[model samples]
Target: MLTINNLHARIEEKEILRGINLEIKPGEVHAIMGPNGSGKSTLASVLAGREDYEVTEGSVTFNGKDLLDLAPEKRAAEGIFLAFQYPVEIPGVTTINFLKTAINEIRKYNGQEPLDAAQFLKRMREKAKLVKIDDALLKRSLNEGFSGGEKKRNEIFQMAMLEPTLGLLDETDSGLDIDALRIVAEGVNQLRDGKRSFVVVTHYQRLLDYIVPDFVHVLYKGRIVKSGTKELALELEEKGYDWIKNEVDALEIA
Candidate 1:
């Protein structure tokens, strides 16, 4: 569903993603894991069309379209959803109203009619239940004064509401306790409908224990240095990243 080839991106001359290449098929969940400053989140942001990162080389294609050519909102409309590492607060906008507008805008972009109040409420209720989000929270300003877990759950709830074809989760497990992690993971798992794909960016293997990626990739020095199954995550947990760093560094020196 998504193909990234030789993808290199930089933020004002400091390169973050260098020579990233990966293929994400329909129904697949790919976990990207690495130590700090390894560009895992940068890849997610680049794919989501975040303006700060300039693509210096390579290309990303989603469902046969040149993904880099599209704007951020265009990417969203094209079925790309990004669950941020830190969800921001929109103090003036209630979560329900914000999501309603977003969904309707996406619908309008696709030449479809917007959901009426009743229709929207029905969908909202269902998604809220699926993600275990509180109705009272949705009525409040988006992410305002919400706990970390609540914000992450809200992100998942937003993902469910949009029903995106590809979900990019940038460290969703960060700052989440075990209970919150499980709740968020379960919500994400429920969205796995055999056609949607996900790229989960995380530093810890514990997240993979819940989300269970089909493929695990180790990214280092702005590139994918290794790719394997879930076993790789276990190995990383057992050994940490120093071994991988030594191997890659040795190769570079050689």
Candidate 2:
């Protein structure tokens, strides 16, 4: 569903993503594991078309279209959903209202009619129940005064509602406790239909325990240094990243 080739991106003068290449097929989930400052989140932002990071080289194709050529909203309309590491708080905008507007906007983009209030409410209730989010929470301002877990759950709720073809989760596990992590993961798992794909960026393997990626990739120095099955995540958890670092450093020196 997504193909990234030799992707290099930079924020101003400092380069982050050096050469990221990966293919995400339909129905596959790929976990990107890396130490701090390894450009894991950068890759997600680049794919989401965040303006700060300019793509220096390479191309990203999503369903045969040039992904990099599209704007951020365009990317979303094209079925890309990015769950931020830290979801922003928008005061004065109720979660329900915000999502209704977003959903209608996406529908308009696709030349479809917007959902009326009753239709929207039904869909909202279904998604909220699927994610186990409280109705009171959605009535309040978006992420305003919500706990870390609530914010993450809200992100998953958004993803569920959008039904994106590809989901890019950037450190969704960060700051989440075990209960919150499981809830979020379960919500994500529910959305894993046979045709949707996901790229989960995380530093630890705990998230993988629940999400259960089909492929695990170790990213270092902005490139994918190793790729394997879920066993790779277990290996990283057991041995840590220093061994991988040593191996990559030795190859560079040689």
Candidate 3:
């Protein structure tokens, strides 16, 4: 569903991602684990069409189309969803209204008529229940004054509402308690179909326990140094990132 070949990126003048190559198929889940400053988030940002990152080299294709050519909003319109690690609070926009606008915007982009109030509300309510989002919280301003669990829950709620073809979850498990993690993973699992895919970016393997990945990738120093199955994530958690860092350093020396 997604392919990145020799993908090198930079922010300002500092190079971040250096020759990253990855291919993910539909119905598969891939996890990217790396330490801070290793360009894990930079890869996600670049894929989501964030403007700050400059693509110095390489190309990215999504579902056969060139992804880098699309604008950030265009990416969203084309079925790319990024569940941000830190969700920003919109103090004035209520959650329901915000989602309505987003859903209708996407629909309009797809050459479909906007969902009328009744249709939008019906779909939103169904998705909210699936994500276990409280009706009261959905009535409030988006992410404003919400607890950590609430923010994560809201993210999944939005994901369920959109039903994107590819979901890039950037550290969704951070700050989430085990119970919250279970609910979030369940929501993601529910959305998984034969055509949908996910790229889960995380630091800890605890999240992997709930959402098992088909391929586990270890990223160090802006490149994917190792790729393996779910066992790789377990091994990393047991040994810590320093082991991988040493291996990468040794490879560079060799």
Candidate 4:
């Protein structure tokens, strides 16, 4: 569903992603793990077409199209959903209204008819149930006065509503409690079918325990330094990233 080749990205004059190459098929879940400054989140941002990072050299193809050539909204319309680590709050916009607008805009971009009020509300309630979001919570302003866990759950809720073909969860587990994490994971798991894919970026292995990625990749210094199965995450949890860092440093010296 996604192909990335020699992906080099930079912010301002400083480089972040040196060269990242990853290929993911439909229904496969890939977990990207690395320590601080390893460019895990940078890869997610670049893929999602964040304007701050400029792609110096590389190509990302999504569903046979040039993904890097598209704008952020275009990427979303192309079925890419990015779950932010820190979800922002719009004090004046209610959750339902925000989602209705976003869903309609994406539908319009995809050349589909917009959902009517009843259709949209029914879909919203169904998706909210999947994420365990309360009706009262949805009535409030978007993420306004919500707890950290609530914000993360709302992100997953948005993902559920969008039904994107490819989901890019950027540190969705950050600041989430065990309960909230499990709820969000459940929602993601429910959406995991043969036609969807996910790239989960995280610093720790705890989140992988719930998500259970098909592949685990170690991103270091803006490149995927190591790739392995789910067991790799367990090993990282046991051994930490120092082992990977030492191996890279040793290779550099050699």
Local distance difference test, candidate 3: 0.92
**Which parts of model 3 are misplaced by more than 4 Å?**
none
What lDDT tens digits, residue by residue, belong to model 4 across residues 1-254? 89999999999999999889999999999999999999999999998999999999989999999999999999999999999988898999999999999999999998899999999989988998988999999999999999999999899999999899999999999998889889999999999987899999999898888888999999999999999999999999999999999999899899
Order of all candidates by TM-score, from best down to worst? 1, 2, 4, 3
lDDT of each: 0.96, 0.94, 0.92, 0.93
| TM of each candidate vs. truth | 0.99, 0.99, 0.97, 0.98
Model 3 — TM-score against the truth?
0.97
lDDT of 1 by residue, 129-193 (tens): 88789999999999999999999999999999999999999999999999999999999999999
Query: Candidate 3 or 4, higher TM-score?
Result: 4
RMSD, candidate 4, Å: 0.8
Residues 111-152 of candidate 2: C-alpha lDDT, one tens digit per residue: 999999999889898999877999999999999999999999
Each prediction's RMSD over C-alphas, in Å, is 0.6, 0.7, 1.0, 0.8
Give the Å shift of residue 15 in candidate 3: 1.0
Identify the candidate with maximal lDDT. Answer: 1
Q: Residue pairs in steric clash, candidate 3?
A: none
Better-scoring candidate (lDDT), 1 or 3: 1
